[model samples]
Target: MTTLKALKGQHHVSAITANAMKNYEFYTKILGLRLVKKTVNQDDTSVYHLFFADERGNPGTDLTFFEIPRAGHTYYGSNSVSTTSLRVPKDASLEYWKNRFNEFEIEHDEISIVSGRATLAFRDFEGQRLALVSDENNVGVAGGKPWDKSPVALEHAIVGLGPVTLTVQNISALSSVLKDIMGYREKGKYEAEGHEVVVFETGEGGTGAEVHVVARPDLPAERPGRGSVHHVAFRVENQEELIKWANYLKELRIPNSGFVERYYFKSLYFREPNGILFELATDGPGFEGDEPFETLGENLSLPLYFEAQRKEIEAKLKPLDTREGGKN
Candidate 1:
């Protein structure tokens, strides 16, 4: 029985999007995050899977989207990842974003202290729930480096992911999976809109690696579609450790997708007791493995298994011009 190292902080959050073109423009031009990977969803190659992140697409910085052109609206409710947080440099960054959001006519809330940090809640073009959290007091997991070329100034740019908010009806069950099985510890609690949000942290324990769970027993289970989160992945050291975790899940009779090779990084996918999809993924053999660092997201990238059908795949996907900056 090899003891696995504790899961590192948050890796990435995969969400659904109805329009990849607009998503690309909004994330890159407005948010100032780099388009790190331009690829198709492995499960369904007909659709695009875009990755946005800090300069290097570091493990903790990735925010991905799976384009489903005909996907329906997301009915807000329980048993879902309600809001995804992005980390900015410091507290003052919120002020810059507040004005930027106004200039772009992006719907947002006023800056306020939530879960002991300054946060600004905002929605994207399709109403994807998001928040910008300041790393002014973050001491645990360090944030990533923002791209110098981002339209947003370097001082106000988003660095990496912050705490993800999960809304569930059964908090006890989800808490057991996060604690007993995954080894996260409850840090504290805060109140928001008449609901209590319980904060949990793992690895080094900071904004970069926290999950804020709020019990919403009053609402129905979410009807997921575009603008909804697909899944939240936690960081693992490597494929070896990922395999160990797969075995551990099997030993405990927790059903999981055993050892999946995702090309860039290996993964193990499973559902928590509350039905939110969760993934454990390796941190290396990253985005740069298949594409060069200088021009990572300029073209459509595919795994070796799918390379043979590149022409067919390209035929199905609508053209998306990602070579906006010329070259990194």
Candidate 2:
């Protein structure tokens, strides 16, 4: 078995949202993540593509979305990303978030211990599920660079994305991809919402290193739309490593999008046996590829191919007001 030693942690989790402004406010104003990229989806030039992350838009911190109002509500079931978990400091930070969520009238669950870590689960404005998992070992926050201008105090600001839950009908097949191809190890298991959940961990077993799988044999397959996760990306070192991963996926006979250039990073996409989309993305040519780090997401950016239609694209996109507390 060829081991994916160059594979790092998660790159980003991409999902769909109906309202662009609502999604923007929730992630930026409410959650305090930096809007690292304001661009249009490469495939769909009209809809907005937004990326949020820690201060620098690091690989593991990214959570991206595509605004598609006409896509309608997501069908909940197997073969989908059920929830995304963000990392925060343990104890005090978790308390701070709970209070903050309360102050903002955000609905969230009481802190529950999952795999020995304190977790507070919540939903976004569009009903996209999310969770904040405390780094019980207190190591993940030490290196995190939070957005200084965020309303949330720097200390309590979310660090980055951690484990993301994938609901699958065929857990055994997906588990093989995580273990044999993606360099993840089975760490622990627990029951959640009546489903048996198995935990997997990658590099060093801390924040940004976990992926949870929930087996949902009784549920039907999901329909992708608003609130539906489009794909989950795993990080590779660079283009070289990305190509290696693409080759590996080919050898495994997994159908994949080979070596796609996404401007900011190169990507190779594939689906596991259960039809959940996954991507292996490189870390470099980061979010700052087009704009300087200081001005990231400050204005609209178009890919080279779409640059010709910038005027038309901008005209079609509904204005997004990211100003403090601005509502749509």
Candidate 3:
């Protein structure tokens, strides 16, 4: 064991999008999140990798998307990161969002309580399943600051990410990876949508530092496509801690992507036993490292490795206007 520390909380959740323009509009305009990064998917430079987060693109606030134009609709099932949660300032914020969703004709469910928190579940234009979790009762893993210029009021704006829900066919298999390997402790269990949801939390347990797993053996394995989660990344301190984790995974004989540089942060990736992709990512050298805070995501950003190829990459990607004061 490296003996550094347990993983902090969720770093980010990356999903798939068929259209980056629409994804950008919906997340930044309707949902009121800031488009913190406009970059290409490092794995496949032909498409965009969009990051939406709180004002500063803080560690636990990012929700990213990789554009795959030809990707089909997702067939929801087991062995997937099913729902990504965003945190609001308080329980009352749920009512604000519910009304906002209705005004925009955005699909959403009524406010409901889960795991002792008020949550409102909704889908984006492409049916990306997401929920806004209330922080009225939250105690650990503090959320980030919402962008001041967001159309949504500051008091009701989303702060950071909340618990990500994982659906698996073999609960024990995933549980072992989360508990035995990742150091998440079983927080509690609750019944929802006809299944028993087991909650687990890592450092400083709260809404921001938890994962809710539910077994769905009755359903087939998920067919991933647009609107489906690609991976959920947990927080590590920095590159040094990330290196320790790489060594730790190596010592355990677990296959992993060793110490990958993401410009914004260092990363290591691996899949849990249930086949759901999980990542360990660092917290620093944030989004502002390259772009100024005033216009963070206004332009396309590229890592140094791709800067030489910028003209070619820019030609392949469709132009996305993320400048402030766009249509709301």
RMSD of each: 1.3, 2.3, 1.0
* lDDT, candidate 1, at 281: 92
Model 2 lDDT, full chain set: 0.83
Local accuracy of candidate 2 as per-residue lDDT tens digits, 1-328: 4445646778899999998887888888889888888998988888899998888788889999999989787778888899999988666788898898999999899988876788999988777889998876744323357788777788778888888999999999999989877878998899888778999888656668778999988999998888789999988888887877878878888889999989888999989999998988888888776888777887898778778889899898998755342112
Better of 1 and 2 by lDDT: 1
lDDT (CA) for every model shown? 0.93, 0.83, 0.92
How do the predictions measure up, each by TM-score? Answer: 0.98, 0.94, 0.98
Highest lDDT: give the candidate number.
Answer: 1
Cα lDDT tens digits, model 3, 1-328, are: 6776889999999999999888988888888889888999998999899899999899999999999999999999999999999999889899999999999999999999998999999999888999999999899999999888888988999889999999999999999988989999999999998899999999998988999999999999999999899999999988998999999999999999999999899899999988888999999899988889889889999999999999999999888777862236
What is the Cα-based TM-score of model 3? 0.98
Residue-wise C-alpha lDDT for candidate 1, range 59-163, written one tens digit per residue: 999999999999999999999999999999889999999999999999999999998899999999988999999999889998899878788989889989999
Q: Which stretches of candidate 1 lie over 4 Å from their true place?
A: 325-328
Choose 2 or 3, whichever is better by TM-score. 3
User: Candidate 2: deviation at residue 86, Å?
Assistant: 0.5
Q: In candidate 2, how many clashes are counted?
A: 0
